[model samples]
Each structure stands twice: as C-alpha cells, then as structure tokens.
Target: MNGGTSTTTATPNPSTTAPSAPKTSKPGRTSPPNSNSPPATATAPSSASTPTPPTASARSGGRTEHAVSPRLPHGASYTLLALGAALAAAALSFTALAAQFDNNVYDWLFRVHPAGHRPHEAVLLAFDDRTLMDHGGVRGLRRTLASTLEILAAAPPRVTAVDLTLADPGDPAEDARLAAAMLRLPGLALAAEMLPDSSGWQDPRPEFLAAAEAIGHVHALPGPLDEINRMIALERAAGRDRRFALALEAHRLALGGGAIVSTPSDLESGGVRIPSRQDAGRPLRVHYRPSSTVETLPIGALLADPARARALRGRVVFIGVTALSAIPDRLFTPLSPLDGNRPMAGVEIHAQSFETITNRSFIVDAPPIIPVALAFALAAALAAAFTFTSAPVAYSLGLVLLVAAHTLPWLAFLGRLVLPPFAPVAASWSALAACAAFRFFYVRRQLASSEQTTARYQQAFHFVAHEMRTPLTAIQGSSEIISRYNLPEDKRKQMGQMINAESKRLAQMITTFLDVERLSAGQMDLRSSSFPVSGLLDACLRRAQPLADRKHISLEATAADDLAATADRELLEYALYNLLTNAIKYSPEHTTVRVSATRDAHHHLLAVTDQGMGMTPEEVKNLGRKFYRTERAERAGIQGTGIGLSIVRQIVDLHGGRLSVESAPDQGSTFTIALPA
Candidate 1:
C-alpha cells in the first residue's frame, strides 16, 4: 500500500503524459511501454512538453500579421527613369546642337542621292574668264551684252533673265546700247537687289527697267551653320514692296506671263504649284541637279560660233559670271566635294531652282511633333525591354533600337520626307543607358539583402542550439530520474522542482527570442504606458543581483523617483535586465557595475557602466550585431551567445530610443539608451 501511493504521486498525470507518448511511439502500434522501449522515451515525460499544433484560425491570423504592404512595382522606377531621359533629349532637340546635326545629315542625303531624269527647262549662259578677257576686262560689258543678245535673237529664247543687277547708271551711250539689245529679246527679266539697310529695293535705271518685262530679287542666303546653300527664299519684302525670286520671275515669264497667285503655304503660277510657306519667308528647298548635267554655254562660246545659240532656243537663259575671280556669288552645294571644295556658280544654282520648280520635285519637312513622338516611342520600347526581359536579351534589343534610330532618317529622306536624326538617336541611347544602370544596381541590392537574410537565419539557429542546451539537458535528466525510481516524497518533489525551473527558463528564452525577432521585423506592436523609471531600474537590479553576487561584484543604481517614461514597460524591462546581466557577467571580481536613469531636455537616458576586460573602439561599434563578440570576452572564457545586446537594442528601438557606447581598449565601457521623453 505504501509503494502504490508513492508511485501514484510521483508518476506524471496520465492525461498530460498521454499526448507526448505517441511522439516516441512507432506507427500503427498501440501497446504499452515495454523493456525494449528506447532510452529516449525514459526522458520524454519532462515538464518541457512540445507545444500543440495551431488551429486553422491561428495559422490564418499569423499570415495576416506578416503580410507585406503594397508598394510600387520595381518596373515603375525603370519606366520613370526612361521617361526622364527621353524628355531631356526632346528638350535638347530645339537647341542649336540638334539643328547642326540635322543639317549635316541633310547634306549627306543630297550628296548620296542626286536628282535623276529631269527635263532641262532652263539654260545658264556663263560669262567665263575668257569672255571677260575677250570683252576687255569687264570695261566693254555693254559691248559684250549687245553682241550676245544679237546672236540670241536669231534663235529667240522664250525668256532671258539677267542675274547682274543694273541698279546703277553706267555710261549713257553704252547703257542705251545695252537697253536696245535687251528690248530685242522675246522676253526679258532684270535682276534687282535688296539695299543694305533693308529699307527698299535697288531697282535698275529707268531706261533699263523700261526695256525689261519683270524685275526679280537676286538674293541667295546661306545656311546659318556652314554657309552652305540648301534652300532659297522665294520672296523678299521691304515695307509694302515685295519682289519674287529671280528663278520664280523667269519661270513665270516662261509660262506665258500671268500673275502669281499666293497663299500662306504655297504659290500658284499659271497652273504650277510651288511649296513656299509665307511664315518661313516663302522658303523653297532646291533639288540640285548635278553640275555635269546642266546645259551651260559661255558668252565667248556663243560669239566664237553663232550656231551655239540654238542650244538656248525656247529655253529660259540665266546670264551671270561663272569665273571664280569675277564674282563673289559662288556658294557651296550639297553635291560639292569635300563640303566646300568645289563651289557652284550662282547662275547654275538659279537654273537648278528653276528646274525644281518646273519638274515639281519637292522635299517636304515633317511636322515639328513627329520627332518628339518618335523619341517617346523609343523610350517606351527601351523601358519595356528592361522591365520584362533579361539583361542579355534586353541589351540585344536595345542595340537594335539604336540602329533603327540612325537609319529611319535616311529611309524617310528616300520617301521625300525630311526627318531630323538627332532626337530619336539621343533619346534611345540615353534611355538604354539609364535603364541598364538602374537594373544593374537594383538587382545587386536585392542579392545583397537576400544574402544578409540567409546569414542572419544561420546565426539564429546557432544561438538557439547554444543558449538552450543547458536548460533542456537539466529538464530531461531530472525527468528521467523522477520517472525511473520509486523514491521518498521529499526527493521526488525536489527533482520535480528542478525540472519546472529549467523548463520555465527554456520557455522564457524562446519568448524573448521571438519578441526580439518580431520587433526587428516591425511585426510586433508596442504596448505604450507611463511607468516610473526608478521602479523599472530597481526591478532590473534585483533580477541581476544573484549573477553579480556569484562573481563577487557589487551593483550600484541611481535614479530619481519622480522621473517617468511612456513606453512598453515589459520590453523596456527586458532591455534593462539584459544590460544589467551583461555588466555583471563581464566585470572583474570585486568590481562595481553601475545602473542609472535620468531625464534631460527631451529624452530619458538609461546608462550601464562596467569595469570588465574593456573593449576597443572597433568592438564597441560592432556591439549590437547578432553573434558578434569581442576578443576579450572569448579569451576570458565568458559563457555567452552574443545575442543579448542585439535583443536589447531591438527592444529599445521599438520604443523610439537610441543606443550609444563610449569605450576604449583597457578602459571600462559605458552603454547608454536614450528614449524620447
């Protein structure tokens, strides 16, 4: 009867022990324990029982607690960067840098593809050097003109346009001779020039003007960038007086002499449409025929053989100086070799302009919005490329986009549409580079974060195995001894108490570890309340007094009773306790550990000072990193997992506090936690 009572009292309750029995039991076996049961079962009935599995509601709540908040997708950053790059390029397009590039490209297109298969509607009667020499060095200009007109009247050209300005009066007898020669032509047009002041036109003398049918302005403006002649202004105006270009006047006379009907965008002369916009000063892009293809007759050639006048029959004649030294009217064309090495005579350029008007071959400029639209399109393509595709494939597609930007302008030019080459190319390159750099850095950051998380998890496992081993072993051993023997009541009670104490310690460790992790991840909600700082410090000192006594160390704490802090009391208590224990554990025997709390202007400062084997400045800086310990502690054989300070730092951070340390080698360390008042 005595043995039965002892066994009943010492044995674990059947209801509590029954659940854990299956953990060691083999599957599909329901027999009671036998002599053959493994030794592990003997220690399984401990106070540290495994926790029950959570229910469905508990698991669902856990997921809800840890779910991440919505944020902007990673691709959005890349897309925004691409847009910025493209917009910068578009803004730069309106500057002179882009226009210069466009001009160069326009010239390249003309040089590569000259006009083909055009009717010769105009002729150039060049006054070469030989013509000037034969006419006595420009002094006999009136005699030369009278002789050339006599030969031209026999064949009778449709219209004769003189490019030389007769605005000033020459010798009266010579001027009258030239005026009579001009009246004998079937059709005559005299050249006028704009005065230097731009106030009025320099018209021919009254006698010369009376013999001519029309007077046109002889002005050929050069390109702003390189002084190359790519286009001509068809109309010039001074106040209310306006005059058509020399080429236009000749075309009008050749088409049987009718009034030129004008609109803002174009001109209509005798049924021919000319694309000359008024807003742009009636600009016309000339389609230059090759110099070799133009029908040119020097004045000396006509005088040497009268038969050469047949070539001028029924064709509008442009008479001007072709000798390079005779006139400064020479200008560069797109077809000029080496940019400006072979300049074309002004008379030939006018003949080409007339041919362009007659042949109806025009190169039209694209609208201003077209380049901007293309830039945006290129940016969008590059953004999508980096967003949805891998790096290698995205870069390959980017290369292709760059090539398309360069080639599109030339292709458009072939179709008779002029597109600027700068905006699309600049935008595409800038966007590609920007997107690639962003993706590169973003991927590197994500990889670094992943590596850090993996390392932290590995450290956590080490901490769990190291810190919980002693308590788990004590609980298991105590349970084994209590379960294997029949003993006195006092002895059984003692073993049971040991198991209970170690099991509670293990549970506390787990709870503290979980709290620290939750707080660091921003998943734990702090419980805020006002508590006296002195009361909190006193409680932590009491808890750490035993450890200090074991090492023969004294603890000194100072706090004002009236001082208080608004924070999570439980978490703050844990933090203060951790600091106290660390101070006591690291201090030398008979040394003192100090704990103090005080309030400043805006914060509650809690400090811990220890006289241990002190730390270097570098070690103090690294104090709060998990599993990081100083060399002094390791050499002193101190028993620690190095996770205590990390937990303390995390807890204080949750209360909107900062942790600071002041220390040096061989000097005691002071750690301070400053909480917002």
Candidate 2:
C-alpha cells in the first residue's frame, strides 16, 4: 500500500519531482534531519535550491526601482504648505476687500492711540445754525461773511482761509461789501472748488480773486471705499491749472508765503517735509487734532461780543459753514463716532488738515513690500515652531504671532507710520489654520498606520502559530524518537526522512514569509530570468498535489510547451503554489482546480480557476488586502490567515505584473496574473 501510494503521488511527471529536490545532494540527504539545529543550517547545503541572483539591471537600479522619488520629510512638506497659504493671504491684502478692512483698522488705531500735544496753529470760525438764522439764512451768507470779516480785521489773523466757493456773481451790493471787508484782512486765502464733472476748477469771482493773496481748492479728498475723510490731497491740478489745498495755501501764507517744492514722494513747503507720494495722489494722512483742543467762535457770538476776534490773532482762521442743515458738506473721520452719528464738517476737516501740516504729524504709509516680507517671515517662523517644538509650545508661539500681527500696527501707528493690519493679520491667521489642520490630519494618518501595523503583526503571530506548528511538531517528535527509542535501522531511516522533509518545509516557509515581507516593503530586488511557463506550472502543481489529494481535489493544468515568461521564476512558482493550495483548501471534495497559461502579442497570462464557495464583487475587490477574509470563508472555518493572497499579489507586482479577480456570488472564481512578455 505504501509503495502504491508513493507511485500515485509521484505520477504527475518526473520533471516535477526532479526540480523539487536539491540538485547538489541526494534527495534523502538534501537537509539535516536534526531539528535541534538552527533553520539556517538546514537551508545552507541547498544553495542550488535558492532563487537566481538579481539581474544586473535590478542591481544597478538599487533603491530607484520606485517610479517616484521619495518625498520631502514631513516637516519640509508641512512648512511649504503653510507658507503657500500665507502667501496667498498676503497677496489678498492688496485687493479692495482687504483695503476696506484696513480702513476700519486704521480708524480703530486712530481712536485708540491719538496724537499728543498738537500745535494749535489753526482756529475755526463757523457759520453755525444760530448765526445763519440770525443773519437771514443762506441768502444772506455774503452779508454775514462780510460782517464777520470786518470784525476779524480788528485783530486780523495771520492767514484767513475761507472754505466757501464764491464762483458766481451774488447780489452786486453784497459782493462789493464782501470784497471791501476781505481787503481789510492782512493775509487772505480764498477757497475755489472743483467742478462737479471734474473737468476744471471753479475759481472765485474775478473781483474777489483779485482781493485775495492766495487762491486754493476746497476739495476734500475722502476715501473712495467708505467716503471717510482720512487724507487730503495736498495738490490738485486740472489741465495745467494747479491749485494747492486750502490748508496748504493757508500754511504757506502763514509761513511768509514760501513757494511749495515738489518731489515724487514728498512735498516741502514752509520748511516742512510732507510725506505725500505724488503717484498716490499726494495723499497726506491727516492727523486730526482732538475736537476739544479746537477753538471755535460762532459768527453770531463773535458779532455779539467782538472780543473773541483777539483769539484768532496769531493763528490761521478757517471760515466756513458749520450748520448741518444748511450745507451738505458733512463727512466721516477716523475720530468720528463709531455709530456714524457725528460727522466732522468739511470746514473743520480743512482746519484739521492745516493743524496736521503745522504740527508735522503726518502719518506715513508703510512701503508695499513691508507687509509682504512680514507675511513670509511670520509663516516661516510658524513652520519652524511646529517642526522643532512640542504641541503646546508651538500653539503658544502661534498665539504670540497672532498678537504680534495686531500689535505691530498699533506700535507703528504710534511712531507715525500707517501699517495696514490686513496683510500681517491675514498671513498669521491663514498660516496658523493651515499648519494646524495639516498637523491634525497628519497625526491621524500616522495613528491609523500604527494601528494597522499592530493589527498586521497580530495576524502574523496567528499565521506563525497556525501554519508552522505542524511541521515543528513533526520534526520535534521524530528527533525525540531517534534520540530516545532503540529502533530498527529501516524504521529509524524513515523517521529521519520525515524529520528532514519537515525541516526543509519549515525553512522554505520562513524564507517565503521573509521574502514576501521584504518585497512588500520595496526592499527586495527581484532575480529576473526567462523560463518555460509549462515547467514552472508543473513544479507548482507537484508541490500543491499533496494538499489537493488530502481533500480529494484534482489539479488540472493546460499550457503549450512553447509558452514562456520573463520574471522572477521562484517568486512566480511560489505565487502559483499558493493559489493552487488555497483552491484545494477552500474547494469541496471531488472538485477540480484549473491552472492555465497563455500568451498574447505583448503579455503572458496565468490563471487559476477554482470550484469553491464564490465571493461577491465587494469581496473580490478586497481579496488581496492583508488580514481580509470573506464572511463565507470565516463561517466555513477555513484554516487560513488571509495573508497568502496578499503575499502572492506583492510578488507579482514586484515583477511588474498585475493580479485580477472575477467572480460573483454562488459561482466559481478566477484569479489571473498578467506579466509583461
């Protein structure tokens, strides 16, 4: 019965049995029978059984086998992402939306940190509601102005600037009286207006213009976004006809009427350098004096007493309408109430402009590059913080950066610099958010990878305990029988043969496991060679035949003798053997597992078809994932660790091949490996 069984087991073909044994030693002496020795000792004599050496191309390729180069370290990648977000936000600072936001911040800084100790060089003589009503309203504006000027002449101011436009002919008698009264003042600057269409200036009447020493435009330049009067254009021109601002004209006359010197970036007049960039419309950021420090004498009150005229003696007097209902020249200011209930009058705004020039309290805007550079520096610092420090330290540093972004503007404002808060604030916030989110997700991914690795190790432990225990027990039992029992020579030789076989099996199992792990990690180099596909299939079938016979399953293979493949032959054999054994293990008794090979013009295809409990499409899709098993297989209590197919897929992929599966519920399954020709 034993001889007949041996004949049946070896009946597949002589070629299969010949390749299964080591070429260098006799079949019985291929490995040592002593299980007490290390596994390496059993494998050492079977050098001819080892896989071929790696091809020259694979050796030269080394670590470059991957199509893509390794990525930058996590710190570098995170820094770049954060910096990109910050740069995007900084670029947004120059847009109109950020400008609008900056305007509000500017106003906030102004209110929080007001100027100290103004020069008090200008006074307001207002045409208040009481004065206008007492002087017969708007129709009597010229008469009221004439009467007020006559009183001011008693103690003439150093320079008197009117914030009114007398561009058209009024009542002739009243105009004559106004001209006569204006001539009594020592120094006079008359206010002209830009036409509504912006085509030209509306100069005062010829008679009145001749009476004034200097003529200036009364155009208050408000912010285009909010219409808030934050700045005043120092110089305005229309078709070769240029006019200084009313406040500039008044200041020039007050300081002995010096000629205004101009430059692209600044204006110098009255021995004062104004930081007003001509390309930016010569904008002079007005440092408005506190309202309480401004002295105002209502025209009606001045006329009633006339003693208040002495208060205007050494100061420039800005005379204009202050009645909110009478004139529509009211506008907002940085110092205006937040609710917008109080808007400064245009005349008062001009007076404040004059005070700004006199006090040399100009708020200069920071250069365009300042904010951009700050954004970059802040982003870099944040990147470094996260990279080198712990979480609490990094987050605390991030909070400090945020505070710096807001506080820097205030400090600069105190130094008379108008630093827009938008850019730095936006950069800090965007970089913080981006880095924080990246770190959050990166940590999550790392944690998930760690958990997966732990689970995989646990599964590997199960595989070792389940698959290797049988061979180990057989080897240990046979070794003990040889060491302790006094048996006949033939019986001892049989036990020794069994121990040797199980040792070789255990060694091969360990080698295959290690090879799969190394290959999956991209650390193994493949030994490429060309071989006949039929011979490879025969070898794999011979190895899996014993397992198939135990379950009463049949192994069937079909391939042409001329069929060939170029790949790692040992790995391919191992993959095919795994597939065949899995098929036998999962299939019902009396079923057949088919192994076939074919070739097309560009590729060789190897397929294994099994008559077993089939898988659903979802199960098929997830088949080769490590530790993944179908519900049916688990329910049937199949003895598997679910890692065999994963190892097979890894081996095929390393050789530039693809493994594909096709199946449906309650039907047989087909696994195909397509290798490059």
Against the true structure, what is each candidate's TM-score? 0.78, 0.81
RMSD of 2: 7.5
- Candidate 1, residues 116-193, lDDT tens digits: the string is 877788888989899998887677776788789888989989999998878887888888888888888977988888
Show where candidate 2 strays beyond 4 Å: 1-80, 338-340, 387-390, 466-510, 525-535, 538-566, 580-594, 609-622, 627-641, 661-670
lDDT, residue 33, model 1: 38
The digit string of per-residue lDDT tens for model 2 on 547-622 reads 5655566787877677778887866887887777777677887788888888888779989888888898889889
TM-score of candidate 1 to 2 decimals: 0.78
**Local lDDT at 635 for model 2:** 93
- RMSD in Å for all candidates: 9.3, 7.5
Instruction: Quickly count the clashes in candidate 1.
Output: 0
